[model samples]
Target: MKNKDPKANFGIELDESIQIDGVSATATKFGESFRGIFRWQQSFFKLVWKQAIIYYIIYVSITLFYSFALDSGNQANFDAITSYLARYTSSLPVVLLLGFFTSTALNRWFSIMASMPGTNRPIALYVASLKEDAADGCARVDLYIRYVLLMWLLTFRIVCKPLRKRYPSLMSIQAAGFLRDHERLLLEKHKEQPGGSSKTFPLVVYDWLNILLRDTCQKGYFSVANDFGRNIDAIQVLKKGGGNVIKFASKNVPVALIQAVTLAIYCYGVVSVLSHQIEKHYLTSVLSGYFPLPYALPFFFYYAWLKVGRIAIDPFGSDEDDIDILNIFDCHINGAMRLRNCYGVKITIPSTDRSAFSLS
Candidate 1:
């Protein structure tokens, strides 16, 4: 069967400078975590490998030729090459071990955050709304943190354990619940505020602040919408959301196929190059020149995938899926009326012309 091109299938371009205001605090936290992961030292190894691969190949080829031409007469050269190869081979295991430990540390940190209280509630309400808003916020925060940590864990498991790939779906339920609860809470809070308050003098300044905050906060809601939308797309493509759909097809089918094929090809190239050195009895060649490609490809592919996946899911970003800021403002305005024990239902949308819009 012909393989698919992952890049073409999943490629999505995004505007780099778009601002998102109404995003949920939890979603923002996930974005921050992802950024942190990218900036880690482990992430930089990929870049190093890319630059070193070609030089490594050339070194390996030269080493093999020298060893064979010397016919075991040069014991010093042979010992030197053997020692170098051993050292190089040993480095891989060390790196892998370090990566494993680092991932464990990160997982523990995430778990601690998830288990902590009140990630969702405003700092002001923590002491008063402990049971309702505060408690719910904490649960939501925990779930959100857990969901992000689950993604990181899945990445580690796929790259390291291999056997734990079966657990990806287990985390999705909590992620979805956390996202839903976050949106609902924000919406409810927005709805409960007054349309206008006596805290401001001219009333115009208060109206503008309400509008600005509403717009800014809606970015959080948009993030939730994008997350849900992407999952839905993935589900459609996989046919079964939880399983490994090796044969699945959809709008994203081309992208998935392409990615798999590219990865296979990259793997094949590295193996082919390495096998050539092995057959020629060129141990030094394998150690010196061909070592970096195997390490580089995975890292490059991962980074590319992250950028493309984000683009695919959030093309319009905060502008498209964002919460209705104006609607929230209207809700807050209407709700504030209840505070004064006024049973009137006539909430007005302030106009540019003061005489035109008035609430009795």
Candidate 2:
């Protein structure tokens, strides 16, 4: 039997207690950050304070006008006006509509993300299935794999505005070592004219991949049924993903729906402020003392919720809250490099252009 000393047991219990304390401290820190009122001052709100200022100015103007300037002596008149507005448009239904709209936008954002394939398992599977006995086979294999990855990058570059900005031209992509000089020349020559490089480059890469698969199958490097066929299907899957990404990028939430919901929120904020003013002027003195409090709290929450919904409406843009397209591209390139390393292949593309160094 293993020795079970009382002192050792006590030491183990003490270590567990210390770990629990650390976990509790972490939980407390998280709660403070998440529930902090100042959290709103930290995000995109910090960069664009003017818009927030306008909102608060309008709200404060209403409060000031009603609390002191408006005929507080005629409480019945103010009550009638606010009560009529509230009866015509209730805030609760508008809030419910906003919640539904936000949920819809969130669902679309998730669907777009799901459509964009980020993992390289299919690429690795295709590469690992191949076998080559001919001399310079590894070099050819490396070229094929690189072309596949470069095609993926180009596809995303077309769909993502930020990535397109990063590699604005074929020459820039070539300089990044993602495309060789001859390949760039070939792609340029194949262009019907001197435009549409983004769309044409992916097609060129697809053609090259198809040719490579044909040659490999004919040379007995791998069976068409087992490897080449599967790779073709995998390429089609990637193509479908690219198509879906483009479709999502091209489409958006109906402009009418967004405008309607936004209008409702703003109207509710105005009516709510009016309602609170009516209560302060006519209600009990105790409640009247916290006049702006009631108006401010609901307005702030409503504005924050609407802002979040707007951000979700287009999650692929250049906004601070949008998806990080560059980071996703980096994951693809890194995974491709890792796959090359796993196959014990070493290859280098000569950097003929130094201008891309700045682009990097």
Which candidate number maximizes TM-score? 2
Give TM-scores for every candidate, taking all chains together and pairing residue i with residue i. Answer: 0.23, 0.73
Give the alpha carbon lDDT tens digit for every residue of 100-128 in model 1.
43344344333322322211122112112
Worst 10 residues of 2 by lDDT: 9-18
- Clashing residue pairs in candidate 2 are none
- C-alpha displacement of 48 in model 2, angstroms? 10
Number of backbone collisions per candidate: 26, 0
The residue ranges of model 1 lying beyond 4 angstroms of the native Cα positions read 1-47, 50-72, 75-96, 115-360
The weakest ten consecutive residues by lDDT in model 1 span 242-251
lDDT of each: 0.33, 0.66
The sequence of per-residue lDDT tens digits that candidate 2 reaches over residues 1-360 is 012132232111122212321123444554654443344533545544564566566656655566677675555677678678767555356777788889888888878877875437555765676663556566765787678777877787766778888789888888777789889888778775667555767777888888987887787776345787887787777777777877786788888888888888778766765664334434653354344555556666667677778887776678766776665566556566556656635468876777656643
